[model samples]
Target chain A: MNAVKKIVKAREFTSFLFLAGLFLVVGIINPAFLSVDNISACFNSSMVYTLIAVGMAFAIFIGEIDVSVGSTMGLSAAVAGTMIQNGSNWFLAFAVGILIGVVVGLVNGWGVAVMKIPSLIFTLGTNGILRGMMYLQVGVEQVNSLPKEFKDMSSKTLVGRFTVYYCCAVLLTIGIHFLLTRTKRGRYFIAVGDNAGGAELVGIPATRTKVTAYLICGVLSAAAGIIFASRIGIVTSLSGNGYEMKAVAACVLGGISLSGGVGSVIGAGIGAVIMASISYLLVFMEAPSNYDNAITGVILITIVVVDALMQHRAAVNNRHARLAARTSAVPGGKEGLEQ
Target chain B: MSDKTPKLGGQNGLRRLWNGPNFRWNLFLLLLITVECVVFGATNSKFLSLTRIFASANGDLTFWYVSIFVTFVMITGGIDIQSCSIVGLTSIIIGVAWQDFGMNIWAAAALAVAVSVACGALSGFFVAYCGVQAMVVTLGGSFLYSGLGLLVSGLSSTEAYKGISGFPDSFKALTKTKIFDLIPLQMIIFLVLLLAAYLLLHRSKYGRKVFLVGVNPSAAEYSGVNSRWITMSTYILSGLAAGITGVVMTSQLGTAKSDLGGNFTMTIITACVLGGTLSTGGKGSAIGTALAAISITLLRFGMPLCFGINKQYLDIPIGVLLVVVVVGRAIVSNPTVIAWVGKLRGKGKEAKAGA
Candidate 1:
């Protein structure tokens, strides 16, 4: 019973369990899918998704969203891809890409925190502007022929098929996750997201915290763009289109709340692997790629409904326990329960 | 029944207009439209011609149709991004029914509308009954419907990329027909739609209930209104609007595809916000949506024709305009900005006195 309680309380546990069960189920149907190389390949492909989901987790943790992450990723990829293709220094290309993302993030933060505009509409507008700029930048030609070293970096693994980029991204995400959950300043993200007014009353500088969250989200999304360019070896104007929804789905799967103040970047990373593996899984399942969006939609609805039902049942059980302990003269049970 | 109040005219009427709740936004929209018109006309003289303006305006019949219902959803404090998907779904359904199932065009249109309404009910159920977030559910719904649209296209044995063309000439004439060689039929259709939406949204008892539900659903429920039912009904209404838009777009394009009205989600939402429909809900008008749609349509046309902008890049100005307008509105409404204006005025007065 205590084990059940612990598992229930640990939100990320379900996500990890789901991830394992997913791989098991698919592996059962196709034994080849269980191979270490194939599975590790899934992790490698999930690097961009993991990055964006972690970034999105930061924004969602702070009780907001940035739909422009897709466009930010796209614009970054386009600009960086262009520079790299044109023989520009790799560092310069990455700097320009990240600079654009920072500018977009600051604008979004100003609109959302300082100017008091809704994050959805603000980021949506940025999405449009960035996508359009990407279109203008890459007219009639995709950016190709990135440097050999950068292109090879995605597959260059020291021990096993795990790419250095995915490893680094995972480690960075875990580090940030610890900082967010364990540090004093890190708690502000949750405090502000949980209740900005209450957080302000307690002197948390809710607006600054929210702004910082957006900045971090921006930086991470820009980093994902850099990784995407390196991994894909090319960038079309529409390279990252519709990726925002995938990231959002990953966050939800990872146990992050859309309404904010819950979940972890580690969970988002796991969820990203699950989400990014769907198209690859399709090959083994012999299903057409057209089912990709539908499958994602079904998974999203299923997990959310399951989560909601579990929460509801837990609430009901808690209420019954409290009532039973209070009204019924259960001395020890009542005393041992939380106040 | 108390009809004895004296009619106010001229200055009094102007005063009433100024004091009205949506007056500033409405006036701002009007001035902005006029300024856009003048600026575009200055850039290209051909843009100012009335016939050309009307011709360009008639092209956005689908947007005008979608915006009216978007206003309805926005007024209720929810958004219907899935309406764009519904347009695609409805268009594909009609095409498949007509071409593959050998159904009559009109009957196929009816079936498409019914299916769209069912889609709305599904999303509405989650939002109203399950207490899920409207945006997230609709976002999911959008994906589901668009995918379903593609699946249906696959079932039709038609390659999805080819789309379903060879629409009947009569159906094509439905959108192409002009009245008296001067006025297009779409203008009249739009005007009638505007009147119907205006009456339904502003001049009806249900409209009052909708507003109350948006403003405070709990209070409305206490007052005997079924808030969930009201909310669900608005989505059905919006779905019906999307169905109409699908038919119009199909006739206009003379084809139906899974990607119909691809950019309309943003376009219509921009129209609603630009025209004065509050995103937070409970404050929008069909008239405002219409005005905004017209302005946006003109901007879409003028940007390319007058300023030589590539069609692909038009989204930049549209996005920048949306952010600027919403942020500008926020600044205008902020108390600190108002106080600063007053302080600056006081400082100017003191400076004049010293001079």
Candidate 2:
């Protein structure tokens, strides 16, 4: 009974358990899987996913989803690559890339907030349009001539062990933590998600708050695109094709609900780690590489189920704990219970 | 009552246009086709040739046909992004069972449809019973089914990118063979499907129930309408349509790729919206959606052929068109414009009376 109680109380804790167990299994299958070099490689590749997931957290927190982030990322990279190829300085190129992201985010927010179009449809259209633009502008031609400094982003080792991108991930997590918990805008963002109408009643501008959330999401997504381009050392039209789904999956795994208003920065960061680790662990098991995508699908479904059950359990536990506290405090409460 | 009855007929015929179930928006479709013909002909004389038009129409018809079914799904306030993945899976299942395993083609097709319908029902169950939002459930579904499609393709001898070919001649005939030796068999199939959908969505009792359910499920429930069944059935119908379209597409292309129907979710949803189906639900038309699909299919093939522009840039025009139509609708609703137009007409009438 106590074991059952323990399991119900610790949801994310259980996810951590499952994630660790996966690594253990992989280590047993192939001892090389636990090697520092391979682990470092996983973190390096995952830095992009982590960046996008954190940005997506803000949008999901504000009761919206940006399916166009993947395309926005792709579009930004294309813009950056094209500008750089045209002899623009790297800084100016990066700025142009980030600007494209902001423009796409603003259009999305306008459609949703001002025009009152549903986010699902509006984002779907934008995703298609932006993706088409990326393909047209960049074609399938890979950009391979990036400056050495940019390419060094993923290659640099920090403290003689961890990759520079991993350090960036840590810094991003801390920054997001400060932005989400310590800031006034972050509180209003949460308030809007929790109940938009109630927040509006209390004088919060829900539309502007939602729009700002998307703007931050857009900027971060573009930054992730830049990192991905640097890591790969080339830009392809396919670069950001499936990434939006991956980022969303990571956020969901990290305890972010699609309905919004609930999640944590640290939890989402861990979620990114868990997902990136899954791919590495599977490869080590000598499992057919083809099964990796299927495994991702299965894991995503399982996580959502577990999250739902955990939410249900938490609700029940809080009710029970409140009842116990009330009974203990009230005079004759014990007598009433006995009767 | 008699006085009001006279007034009804005394009003201008144009006044009834807005109140009519099928209005000028429907008529606007014909104008677009005429404009397309004239523009394309002027730009490229070859565009008016029979073979070019037929080839383009044949290749694009299946997608538009399938999108017509999505119009129903959208009307019920549900989306089925998984339909794209389902199309791939169905085609592969048909290909493997019939071609590789040497099973009966009809039986394989039926099994494929069953698989698709079952997948749709699973999505519906999540939405109806578990209280999950339809968009999230379908988005997850798109990932799951697409992954499943790749796995199924891997099981077959055909490479994932190369796709499955060598389908039976009769199956190919489903898409390529002509009805009157002129119209492609697929277009005929599309027309028949459109007619069926038109009757199902407009003339049937259940159709009315679907609109009610979408408009207000709680109120519908109180009215003793089985909103759950209505919602679930739309998904099943959507699945069936996707499955059939998958079979037709595979036949038409002479191959089955896991990504064959990839990127269709956006196109179908766009077609639905371009037809003026409210994304929030309770307002849609099969006829309007079908016309929109036709327009889109023509635009995709016609623009590049006429202008000699890259096909990839076509998304710009389509996106701009969608925004324009939506914004135009909003502008039409402004009271100031309507009143100003009315005053101008009234002043003109007074001058005519003086004359």
Candidate 3:
């Protein structure tokens, strides 16, 4: 009973419930959505978003944002896709893609952590530079005609009805969640984000931790890019155009606090599923695909507003309780309070 | 002491003027503008033509128009990525109202501005009252408003690709008419707006309150300032500016489309930051923004004309400029770096004495 209660009280549990409720409601509206194949497809398709959102969660955990993630992803995908289309070794292409991620992460880390530039502004600067470079390389051309086996690799499943990508992502999220919760050094991210000065006083290397967080974020986003190229079989200059916003939204939906130092990769993975499945669910509901952006916006605003209001109410109630406790502890409380 | 005061009066007076509010920054911007003009003019004689310069400046009014009011938003330590979407919303509203409803063009414009202001107020409420991050709220607003713009565009009989054109000549004259046949009317409008922004931001009590709120919100609240309202009002001003840009752009281009300002999100922020507005808030000036906008406009104009670079490649230079200028400013202002420099100078002096 205690274990169940703890599970119910977990922040990620709320996101899980939301996801389940969404699925139930959609299934009710369209029975076809309830099928095993379609349900598994939703999870399988969320692989890219899952990786991106988890990466974004790392940045948010350290109390900063990286608006350049989309551009980084685009550039990496363009590089990997172009190389693969040119008949290069897959491993070499993947290595080059990850190398691009490392370079971007280092630059972003140097600017933001070492130079102390605001992450948003610095990343936005890099975002523009990367986007320009992408344009220069692609020049209005899309990288296509990828190898058939590579494209077919996305459909390869590891377990019953679950793609290898989705299973690995879930396991990775769980492993990271375990490390973050159970390990001492892994908790440094939350500590620095919660209070940087306090963390430094306690001998944590705050700057290095922040750089590591951004590094992990960049690596995950690049991995997502490689997966994206394989799944889509084409890489346009606009491939990852607005994924940054969606990833942020996914992180928030997953119960991660934007203010930082709170949440888990598991929640982020769950949130990614919800974000990724929106358009797929919309098709079942017979809604116009054009409404996708509007719906995402509405959902984002609604969840955030509701969260704010709940936090406000909790704060008010806690204050009232503290006041009551103080008053009740005093003998002859009214006279004591007056004194 | 009395003798020193007299001896130092002239030099101190000059120093005080040099150190005056935004004086150094404004002078730097002026120097940059002059250098750009000289280089561009030297490269291409046609770039020196007054008529051509005015025309190019007039064409880029969409940027500075939004920057003027966005500077107010940034001063309050909040950002509005949604302003570009609001610009799109305003354009589509004006187009739909004038074409489909057959309303007067001016009335359509007024309605559009009102609606845009409401959009700003909504996002501001979320950011200020609900304590949501400005970036998130504005990002969501960008998506919502752009989607709404598309929905509105669907109401028009004209196809989305074609856009709504055939605007009245009288309405079109807003951009076409020039004062003295040398200066574009848009330039005059820009000057007036710049003056208005300067007065509102630098000379008004409300502006001081905004600065205080941005500098320290809880303290501002304790001091009886309605910080939330002040923050929200800046966003409204931003929305109003975006609406004006929408109308001006439509008049300038002789058409209205849902995506009129689709690609202007970064350029607007760049202009503000390049002008010395702190992205973290509490420090900015209107003159700095205007000068920055003009310099950037000239760069964009000159790059294609003089170097034969494609307009598409402009983002590279602009991005490099933003990163370098901001990072340079950070390094210059950093206390540790200052102390390091001071130490190096002291060591040099000590070595000289030992020698």
Candidate 4:
């Protein structure tokens, strides 16, 4: 019973329940969507979104945001795609792509963490610069005609009904979650985000933790970019254009507090699945694809409103409990006075 | 002696003027505009013509209009990314109302504005009353409104790509009229709006409440100011501005589409931030935003005309400018940097004494 209560109290549990409920509703509406294959396809399609959301989770955990994730994803994909299209070694292309992410992460971290610039503005700046670089690289053309093996790798599954990419993303999320919950160094992110001054007083390197969070976010986003290239098999200038917002929405849906110091990467992964499945579910429901954005928006608003109201209720309950304890304790004092 | 006294007094007055509120930022923007005009005019002599400059500036009236009211939102320490989507929503609403519903064009426009304001109120309610982050609410609002716009467009017989056109001549005259054949009607409208914004933001008690709320919301609440309402009202004002922009843009382009103003999000934010509005809120000015809008419009106009750079590549410079300028401001305003600089100056004086 205690464990069940704990599970119920966990924020991610609620999101997981929400995800299940969503699937059940969609499945009921369209019996065809209840198939094991179709359900697994939802997870498979969410591989890229999962990686991006998990990456985004780090930023949110540290109480900052990186609006440049989409551009970063686009830039890296363009770089990797161009290199691979030119018959370059795949590993080398991947290296350069990840290198681009690291450099951007460093610049963003330096601006936001070291230079003390607002994270939103700093990332917005980087977003523009990276987008410009992407345009310069891709020009008025899309990068296509990649090797079949590279494209086919996205379909290669390591587990039943799960692509290698999705499996790897899930494993990576679990690993990060373990590290975050079990390791002191990894926990510094939530610590810093919870209270930077207090964290500093306690000898935690708050700035360094923030920089590391951005680095991890950048690395993961770049990885997602490589996966995006392979999955889509074509890279356009507008590729990953609005994924940052989607990732943010995913993180929020996963029960990650925007104010930071809360949530797990696993929850973010779940949220990504939900976010990525919207279009797929819409199709099953026979709804127009144009409703995708509106549905996502509605879901985002609903979740956030619910989260706020819950927090408000909890605060009120805590105040009530405190008051009750105080008033009851006064009876003990009154008895002592009678004695 | 008398001549020297007047000159000295004048010098003192000039210094005071330079130190006045928002004057420095306005002057900086003026200088930037001057430099841009000179360089672009030097490169293309036709650029110096008043008609050409005004025409180019007039093209970006949508940005000016949106940023002017958005300055209020930013001053209240909130942002409205949904404003761009609101523009599209307004345009499509007007198009659908006039063409499909057979309503009067002006009545359609009024309806559009009302709907847009209602949209703003929804997001503002979430941000203010619900205590949700403004960024998340606005981001979601952007998606929601744009999606609604697409759905709305579906109702009309006109194809979304072709847009609705062939409005009444008098209605079209909103953008067509020019004063003295030198200035566009849009420019005059923008000026009037700018003045209204300036007065609302700088002169009114409501404006003071907005600033107080932005500077410290809890303190504002303690002082009996309804900070939430102020914050939410800013979003409404922004929506109203977006509605006006929609009408004017549709008039200017001689058509209305669901996707109109879809790409102006970055430009509007760029105008506000470049004009010296703090993204963290509590500090912004209408005059500064207006000047910044002018400077940006000129830059966008001048780059292609003078430097042969493609219009699409302009984001690079704007991005670099934002990062560099903001970072530079941060460094300059940092107390540690100030102290370090003071120490260095003191050391230099000591070194001079030793020498």
Interface RMSD of each: 1.4, 2.3, 1.1, 0.9
Winning model by lDDT: 4
Backbone-clash count (model 4): 0
Tens-place lDDT digits, model 2, residues A1-339? 998786455434555676677777778889888877876676666788888888888888888888888988888887787777667898998998899889888888887776666676677778878888887878757676877777776788885577887787878888877778799877887888889999999999999988888888889889888877778778877779878877888887777787888776666676777778776776788766666666776777666755665667888999988987888789989678668
lDDT of 3 by residue, B200-228 (tens): 89889988988888788999999999999
lDDT of 1 by residue, B235-331 (tens): 8888888888788888878889988968577788788888788878888888888888887878888999998998788889889988988888898
DockQ of each: 0.57, 0.38, 0.63, 0.75
Identify the CAPRI category of the predicted complex in candidate 3: medium
Task: State each model's C-alpha RMSD to the native.
Answer: 3.8, 4.8, 3.2, 3.5
lDDT of candidates 1 onward, in order? 0.85, 0.78, 0.88, 0.89
Which is superior by DockQ, 1 or 2? 1
Residue clash pairs of candidate 2: none
TM-score on 0 to 1 scale for chain A of candidate 1: 0.92
Please list all clashing residue pairs in model 1, or write none if there are none.
Answer: none
**Order by DockQ, highest first:** 4, 3, 1, 2
Q: Taking the true A–B contacts (Cα pairs closer than 8 Å), what share appears in each candidate?
A: 0.47, 0.27, 0.48, 0.68
Candidate 1, residues A157-254: lDDT per residue as tens digits? Answer: 95577889988988998899889979999999999988989999999999899888898888888889988989988888888888888898899989
TM-score of each: 0.92, 0.88, 0.94, 0.95
lDDT of 4 by residue, B43-113 (tens): 99977888877888767777889999888888888888888888888999999999999999999999999
TM-score-wise, the better of 2 and 4 is 4
lDDT at B321 for candidate 1? 88
Model 3 scores a C-alpha lDDT of 0.88
Strongest candidate by DockQ? 4
